[model samples]
Target: MVSAQPHRVGAELWGQLEPNAGLIILEGSSRKYPYIDAEALVWGGAGATQLGSSDNDATFEALVMTIKVRDPRGVSDTRLGRFMLSTGAVRAMHIDGGHLMLRARSKTHFEVFGGVPVDGNIEGRKYDWMVGGRVSQGLGNKGMIGASYYNRFNAGQRSAAEAGGAAALRGASWVDPSAKISWELVNPGLAEVLGTISAQTASRVIRGELYVTKRSPTRMLQSTSLFTVLGDPGTLAAGGNLRWRAAPRLDLWVNGALQDAQDDFGWSGYLRGVLRLDDDGKGSILGELRRQQVATSSWTGLRLASVIPLYEDHDTTVGLMPEFEIIFPDHPEPNQGNVWPWGRLALRWQPTKSWAVAAAVEASANQIERYDVRALARVSYQGQWPKK
Candidate 1:
């Protein structure tokens, strides 16, 4: 790993011979305020290979690059490019092309982006492209209004399989076009509202959300969201949450979502409460209840977790966390419900400002049937190099 102010780069390489697994990764990023920022990454891996086989053993797991530039005034631009050789590339979406985005602003703002795939497969084709843009006008204290459109094209230009079969699978036009109108209503410290209505070649959707919060010795917050998708059967969803901290030591929260699709309706709810025993919150307990019903099946569960300080001194501290959970399923079979109990004991020793050691062990069991255990230990040291 290498790092500097506003810049960082890291890489990891690992291999195992017993089962024949190997991985290679390289990533780096840099940022310069009010000027430019850039990042690049390449990662690939392979598993279980024969020493002298003639098969293709190389895979181009993932490659990505991003760059952003901003002027001191009202202009900014960004570019993103990606290529994936295998679907196992983690933490990134598969993209075989590059996209460029530009924005200019004053009171009214305009944004545009376009991309063309350089490699990989899309919609049974070897190449594809997309273009999109948005325009927005500021409304002072009220908020802003914007409209955006995006279109994708050339989705079936090449095929690795039968030409006819590929064409048939990708449909007549591999292009998708979508447009949306969005509005924002801002009230600053009190509340805010946002809404958008969008239509695509396949479906139309409307979404709205509201948030209200108050910050004080006793904090409170509330949020709600609604979504409606106009597809073949259509679907509607609504959800909201409320959280309140009556004191520094106590808090309560609840959230639930309800969805209706055609003749089916489903909903889920979660409730949680927390209590702290110390001003620093080093000792705390939490309890949660969750319930969900989908189609014809439903389940409810309760969980309780706690953290207690076993020993604490000037430079060393030890803690323990005990957790328990039980679930009830809406089924007629016996032994369908289970209880899980788990606990973790941890120790931390920091004798100096530059060195520390920590260790933890966790164990759990299900309904007194079977048990599993895990242990972890780590030592860390930190130091500063001489300035150049």
Candidate 2:
């Protein structure tokens, strides 16, 4: 598990277990401000079987519990938490009984869920908990599908105007599934194509995604396409990245697309690469080259990076990393001679499995470069949950 703060919730990895089961719970600050926050996760069922012969087996169940609240630093805040369990390979269920607050990037803002706060300011806070179910299946070696539904809630019995908006906490939002097929030829040739399409009536939105990749003796590349139709007047559309490694530690790539909903057709791509010297054991030097084309402009960039790890005792280790980058405008404009340089320093200490912590800081700059400071500290207690 990794988190920004001691009390902050984050992600969890169960390692590479052929058939293992466990539960994980996370809580963290989304907005990291006065109040508004969010939490999200991927989980499995509890006390599930590994497809032996019994449906009551308890060895293969995986569960996830996540809850986020407002005013994490204050008293009397709202909370949201849910537990999902895996009953079998093709069968699983979840119970949603916690409060929730959801927010998106820059578009659709503010979704109040599960037990609204009494502050009366709908901008933040949530009300009511919704329950739902989800089912998923894997197809052959390149396809998967999933579908789910849940119910919504409210503060209390109220008139239509005071009842807030419609809660989409229940019912099947949409069925989502995707497939990818690949073919490999000898050691020098390979090709793959993938696609996905989803439409939801509750939100009145339709989405489509496509991806393709091809590799040959001397070069390899991949690209993606995305299109979204919102019930509203606007639509969202874009594409993915394309990268090619021309030589050892050398790469070139470009990415961009149109987001009609935002009235923007922005795209930018670059050429970047890294090189390592004396890679056997001592140290190494790295370099990069890049060029980018946006909706209305073109630019070029470069990067230089290096790292070294020093060892003394068998129990302790230290490393240092530094990098620098510069960008030049295609058609020399005002403040066009822009350059950015960034660097990081890290220290690690691991006395035992029960204790370990790493500290790091980074700084960078642009044309009007400003040195920003950041730090991280971690502490934990480990006894091997399964004691393997």
Candidate 3:
């Protein structure tokens, strides 16, 4: 009891570097016995200076550190520090703020949060605070309806006042629909609506997913900058997908989407199939055919990928993965060829329970360059103190 179990701790690290520069990211968490946990994460790059010298300035930022607490009775909870909040139809927002949730006895819950935008490009600090709230009520059994509102200023100007509503059906065997609508209260008054319906057969051999989205792209930016003038009316898209289990080891899918925009009318789709080579499914291969067209540009592509298990045991495993893609562009770029192809082969080894290493090489031709190749190696570890 006095030894404290050797102060147990586990960590994982991974990054891609060399020939092609990349960043390293770290994430860790700590917890106590009662009901509190704290976590921090950081990721940044080592890059050349502004003047383009040989020396590299490395930067790793710890932008997130948060703690959460909840009442034992499950009636209320709160989160403090930096975290991401995504409510109702609102996309995820990364802010340094706190969130509170209260659930009443009548199957209704309310949530509220406020925070300042935590980003590098945010210019003004005085008018950067953001706030939003959501309220939801559960239906008799397997459904709920919710409404949310968000407001904030950016660059010392009134940027947005967004309101959204959503309704969904949960835990249903047949087709279920979830729909959301959001509107912006700014001058142009942008609005959006999206819906999804999914179904699966009782035998679970076939499935279907359908969705449609109509939204204004300009809503992504609420700044007072002149760039906002570049936004147009809106875009509408409708898509559906079907999944079929062709055999005990084979699955197939077909999906496509159509878009109608003022500048471009286009559609994109893919047909894919995967065959399991072994019982574990790790030794599997996938093939896909994809095609897309917009305005005056269009292309058809073929992709093939496979995973091969070389060695496997209780504590260690070795694997090989290879992928290739070829695209035939109707109209090629200025310098690149009409046919674009890229291929990669990788081998990975996990020597022990928590140690892993992988090496790969790839070659590709793109609009910027033709006939280029590169190689990379990476290692990662996940282990706990006292030998787990």
Candidate 4:
């Protein structure tokens, strides 16, 4: 057995090890300038690298260095530095840049941002810069409607350009249902739309979401990618998900999706259920069944997992969990059987809100190997000041 331990390399650095994987992360976040409206975040690994780097070029993988300032009265917010973008006008991306958001007393808001595009592939995508913006107007007291624009460039050549509109409604009342239709529309040329509704009655709660997505590699992918070679066939996909809390401690979820690509429709979906054994919800059992039909293959998968409290020492709490999964491929794999199986047993301990340690043994049989087994351990910690 390997002694997988957690180490503190610095005041705010945390590290964890597991046989073939190692991570040393440095992170810190704080509020300053009268202490509430100014903030900066730093997160990276060992020489400030990534979580797990096995390639030479990834020695110093990536880092997040950003500072943010907000107006005390909520008039404006600004940020500068290197960070990852969230799901917005375009796909989420890591870049170096600046952002500004302004709110007017008239219930109007505006956002503008510009930066450089970045990813894992080194020396790829001769990207020089990118910029985007959004503007929205509030509708009475329920929701808001907005539109956005985004564009990217490759040195001297424009790589992509897209535009879209969006509208949202929450706590909607039947008296005014005008703003509740066709939720979001972004980049209709290669756009996406999503909307969700929820209802609750006593011990049961239900939520449903519908989405549509369209993508074209010719306009979205980098020029150097093989996707450009395939031209712009485009893809349209629709999917829906339903989540229900049937009881105080039981939950069920179902999801189904269909994709339109290359003159055909492909389908995929899954059903999952979970039950809690205790009121605190620390112990639970879960099972899931999935059916996947893609362009290249079709298969059915099953998964079962459970966790239960085992031992407690002083302030520390320990638990045991066993998980199993298997997949049945319609056809035999290359030199392998038609079935693949995997299992794992884990023991975990949590002594405080900031620290957790887990040791696990996993065994599997797949096309890559007839039978492979491994034992591993991991430790993690998080710290916060002025605990609020």
User: For residues 1-388, could you state the per-residue lDDT of candidate 2 as single tens digits?
Assistant: 2223323334333211222233333335443444544445444433334433244444432233445455544332444444442211111224444433333332222222332222223422234333333333434333433332233233332201111111111123454443332232221223323333333344332233332222121111111101111112322334554444444444444444433323444444444444444434334556666665544556777777676665534655454556566666666545524545566665555565444555556666644435544443444333322233
- Residue 54, model 1: Cα distance from true site in angstroms: 18
TM-score of each: 0.53, 0.41, 0.85, 0.77
Clashes of each: 0, 25, 0, 2
Looking at candidate 3, what is the lDDT of residue 36? 45
Q: Positional deviation of 58 in candidate 1, in angstroms?
A: 9.9
Clashing pairs in 4: 45-49, 164-187
Cα lDDT of model 3 by residue, 56-144, tens digit: 76655555677777665557778889888777867688888998888888879899988887772545545677888999997856898
Superposition TM-score, candidate 1 onto the true structure: 0.53
Report lDDT per candidate: 0.48, 0.39, 0.77, 0.66
lDDT of 1 by residue, 290-331 (tens): 998867758788888888888777766666666676676666
Check candidate 3 and list the clashing pairs.
none
- Cα deviation at 380, candidate 3, in Å, is 4.3
List of clashing residue pairs for candidate 1: none
Task: Give model 4 RMSD, 1 decimal.
Answer: 7.3
* 2 against 3, candidate with superior lDDT: 3
Best by TM-score: 3
In terms of lDDT, the poorest run of 10 residues in model 2 is 159-168
Off by over 4 Å in 3: 1-10, 18-34, 48-55, 120-127, 188-190, 352-355, 371-388
Q: Candidate 4, residues 1-388: lDDT per residue as tens digits?
A: 2222232221233233222433444444444321122223333333322345443322433356666676656788787777776424455778888788899999889989888866533564555687888888887678778777777676556665666666665564422222111111122244344444444444337766666666564655655455666666767777888889888889999999898777677999999999999887889999999998867668999999999888766678999999999999877767897789999999998898678888888988887777878676667677665454
